[model samples]
Target: MHIEKNTFSLIEIPKIIDEKGRGNLSVIEKDGVPFDIKRVYYLYDVPSDAYRGGHAHKEQLELLIALSGSFEVVLDNGFEKKKVMLNKPNIGLLIPTGVWRELENFSSGSVCLVLASDVFNENDYIRNYSDFKLFVGA
Candidate 1:
């Protein structure tokens, strides 16, 4: 790995729970992430055996949150790999630029919310693993 695997980690979103009859609420405001938020999207109805995210961004930063159900995210920083299980609605996996990622093992009705640092741009993506290694100069 040209980049350090430890660069990625989970972030807790602040929330408020009602002591009365209401449920809990989470908030991600303007200073919530490391970069400015430019886009937001979610994945749902994914087959349990299916996978997503087989690319790395050269300049985009992302945060993956499990809004419902659960899934596993594998992060690779050219030289090392780390597996993280995201099950909680209030926790997110923060991914920096130049790191490869793969998402799989999704539970039933799983929802994946992704917050990105920029709009969709095809030029920023490194889609193939072999090319990714070469991009990172590994």
Candidate 2:
């Protein structure tokens, strides 16, 4: 089956707030995500005008969270495209395989935290949009 841009979902992470005016905390355990997390990484100190991620995965599922500030994620699933803004730490966007993704509009001090369903595998990536479109037969 083919995945579409509408298939993506935004997940709200559970949070614990301190009543003493301290701070807030969020957790992502086994059930927090649909797939088991096999890898974790983060992007930080990105210029607001810079763009990151211009590829689609063949067999990877990812959850992107704004751990600090804010950024926008542009997603294309061969047939359609959508833009999602991530500004809160307690929210995450679930990206399924076969969908192209791009990151942009980063605010100052923005940090992007990513949780993956698989480890690094260059072969699983489609680096070109045309190739991605061909692969998806769109």
Best by lDDT: 2
TM-score, candidate 2, is 0.95
Q: Note each model's CA RMSD in angstroms.
A: 3.0, 2.3
**Candidate 1: tens digits of C-alpha lDDT, residues 39-121:** 99999999999999999999888999999999999988888899999999999999988799999999999999999989999
lDDT of 1: 0.90
Tens digit per residue, CA lDDT, model 2, 23-119: 9999998988888899999999999999999998988999999999999999988898999999999999999988899999999999999999999
Residue 43 shift from truth in candidate 1, angstroms? 0.4
**CA shift at 25, candidate 1, in angstroms?**
0.1
lDDT of 2: 0.92
lDDT of 1 at 1: 17
Residue 42 in model 2: lDDT: 98
TM-score of each: 0.94, 0.95
lDDT of 1 at 98: 77
Please report, in order, the local distance difference test score of every candidate based on alpha carbons: 0.90, 0.92
